[model samples]
Target: MLKSLVVMAVSFLLSTAAVAERLKDISTVAGVRSNQLVGYGLVVGLDGTGDKTTFTSATFRNMLNNFGVAIPPNIDPSSKNIAAVAIHTDLPPFAKPGQVIDVTVSTLGDAKSLRGGSLIMSPLKGADGQIYAVAQGNLVVSGFGVEGADGSRLSLNVPSVGRIPGGATVERTVPNAFAQGDSLVLNLNHPDFTTVRRVSETINSLLGPNMAKAVDATSVRVRAPRDPSQRVSFLSVLENLEVQPAQEVAKVIINSRTGTIIIGQNVRVSPVAITHGGMTVAINENIDVNQPNPLAQGETVITPRTGIEVDEGSGHMFEFAPGASLQEIVESVNQVGAAPGDLMAILEALRQAGALKAELVVI
Candidate 1:
């Protein structure tokens, strides 16, 4: 009976571990990937926020000349209010011609802002130097900026960068074909040997034995039907096949610049002792006036002196029990009576001292 109890306990633990996370969020099949496309274009209809015609004269003249308007070779076309910009977008898997995709346009010139601007017909080219799409639409700028006299100004978020929703039309198609091949590759977004092997094993188990194999830590190769129509069905079955992916080790990531800290759910700290203390020094200046004989037209003078004071914190150290939960760690640290900034330092020290079990990644 005691042996049976041990077996039941192990079974319960395994069942709990199986439902920790979904496989779809952690792993992906390889052949499916997004392609990057880029192009240069001009933005028009700016209310004086466009590039100055004087500085970028050549760009303005070329754009006008493209529309069959000829400027003399000697003439400088710098005064037209147009901004040159670079457009970028991702071409998803199975993208075809004539489909619309969103594009982002960023000013390549000294344009103050792209608010209330329309992107002209810009041919976005791929790495092959071929026109893959053309982007032309009204830009949707999300940020606001204002400036006034006396150097008064207010701005929220980024003003110069903006995104255009469905602003580009596909003009060409990439040559990559996944449905026509006899084999499919699954690519893991994060390369992990254990996860890859488990995904391959799961796929093979769901399909037929030896149907999927790990090519590397980041890729899995699977055999599929040769016919395009059958391959599509095969992929449909492949994507729906579920696999219990391995769990990521617990870790905590902290960004010092923004004072942001993200703790993984699995993060746990071993019980340890901590103590924090600091001294604060403050100085204040006071002025005094000494006037010689007010009625006798005496010159007035001012004297200044400063008062110095020190404030120190009374600190005590407390030992936490082993296998302390995150709450326990936080409470023990807070008992030191330190500010958040000071606590950040204390946590760093604790992590370095081998007390923190979770990986501490500071950025």
Candidate 2:
């Protein structure tokens, strides 16, 4: 049994390590990333579902003034077919001028819905407070709602938000350091010293010694060609190289809300014994009648009787051997027929007693 258990554990580790991943899947170029652009705008053509805030009215008056149609201060347009909204989109890395991107529009006021609305021309700005793109398009709302005269309503998905595919045209490009540095840095999605060392070694094996260096646990600096075209080709090859990552640390994850428990393959338990049991008590009430047998004048009376019962379930004791593997722990728990809550208590107790040789995370 012990031999089979060891074999199974070794096989599990071997299988996990055999899964090699492309460098592009595991790491990203240090300076290449997307930027977020945001803007405030107004959506028109709503059917009696527009915002009635003072700010919306002010924005409407300002827009009309821009078109040389001034409105008197004493009169309010009170348009119910317009809604104020916020627009946002992600400017992809290497996005050039005139390229189109998708944008999300959401209402900013008490508007019931933004269905059948068109966004006005709005300038999207980046973190540097510079206009990067212009957004204007009809919205594609997926959700709708309905209300009855009696105040009862039924709704599907949210109707106050919508998306416009390829709605924004890029007008500016965010500069990156991809072409300015002599060496390029690759940042790992997940940092690990062993993984970084292995990545450096793999790159060096392909380009010769001293060509790649592990700068830290999360980054590797690699020498590349100076010419732009040659550098692109060099990076393309490096990003495709296959490298095996190190195994994750031993951990047990518990979702407190959903009662989900996940045990990692590396989790182990020291020798320990545990017992689970519970006691149940039940009480029942019964009504009894008292009657006069010989005396004819006696009145019948009623009384109440109560009965109590106690049951103690048979407790089962389970023991774990020293350096028990994840499979062994699971098998032992199954043998005891422990429920999810019971298993959680057992694991917590083991952690407190220093018998669980892994990190216990309750999320």
Candidate 3:
């Protein structure tokens, strides 16, 4: 069933029909993106699967000090219920104070699992070393493990990493140039000269001439109203405008390990003939025992016999007409009953011979 689904997905990817897509689906506004914030924190309430590292102990002491509880310099707490962790979350664009976002917690020490653990309040900082949010919540772990007394263990998924939805409360805002600039830049998800030109032309046609211009293959600069409110409304309209994107480049993707082949719709094969076959060799070994006569010396000898056989598989030859389409190529290969590996070899050979009109990518 899984194999059929994979084949179906590949078939879908082979489609060549061009469709009109919304501008928002193909491009993003410049300087409008998520900010990554990370922090080092601790997770507690583990079931004897905590870190034993010295740094974990030190962090525990520091956390206690913040709570007005001091321990002796030489005294060390060896608790098995605490584990150090690292927290990270993305601060979305235009996020305000008190807004909550999801956070991912990963074990930073030698902890076995983070299941049933609670994360302590930790400050998440951006690249500029400024705190942006605070995270504190119970971890939601989807993976766990169990160990036997004889050292055998069973595990499912990853138990050391977890997520806490709406765990971090935003405390700071990352400023952007959305309202300060007179022009906005649209960056294409897939850079192409034709696509950018079409985007600029589409915008110009909607508004007036000289309203949008293509800066390069990946960007389209557009003039906009200076007022923030007008800019927001203007962008809302522009994002929904539909335009047909340029067709993708012709290419072939091959998964060598899984024996999966993906041929793009634009892939074509020049006039070529291919032959595929296989050879097999078999060997057999036999042992024969020779016993002396009843009254003769009591000694037995053994002799070995060997046999070998060879078979040459039936080679099938197929031909591709000039500028063969994807369906024709598939039919030709299927008629020859060629396996994935054989088909990959045939494609590579065609590429080497300059007959395959597409870039062959093996992964």
Structural similarity to truth (TM-score) of each candidate: 0.82, 0.87, 0.93
lDDT of 3: 0.91
Query: Could you give candidate 2's per-residue lDDT for residues 1-363 as a string of tens digits?
Result: 333443465567657765999999999999999999999999999999899888889999999999999899999976889999999999999999999999999999999899999999999999999999999999999999888999999888999999999999999989998887689999999999999999999999999999999999999999988888898999999999999998888988887787777778789999999998877899999999999876588888999999999889889998999999877887888777777778789999999999999999999
Off by over 4 Å in 2: 1-17, 279-312
lDDT values for all models: 0.75, 0.91, 0.91
Off by over 4 Å in 1: 1-23, 53-55, 144-159, 266-271, 288-303
Error of 1 at 187 (Å): 2.4
In order of listing, the candidates' clash counts read: 11, 0, 0
Q: What C-alpha RMSD separates each model from the true structure? A: 7.3, 4.6, 2.2
- Tens digit of per-residue lDDT, candidate 1, span 234-323: 777777666666656667677788665555545666677777677889999999998899688889999998999998867678886887
C-alpha lDDT (0 to 100) for residue 152 of candidate 3: 98
* lDDT head-to-head 1 vs 2, winner: 2
RMSD of 1: 7.3
C-alpha positional error of residue 166 in candidate 1 after TM-score superposition, expressed in Å: 2.2
Q: What is the lDDT of residue 283 in candidate 3?
A: 94
Instruction: Candidate 2: give the clashing pairs.
Output: none
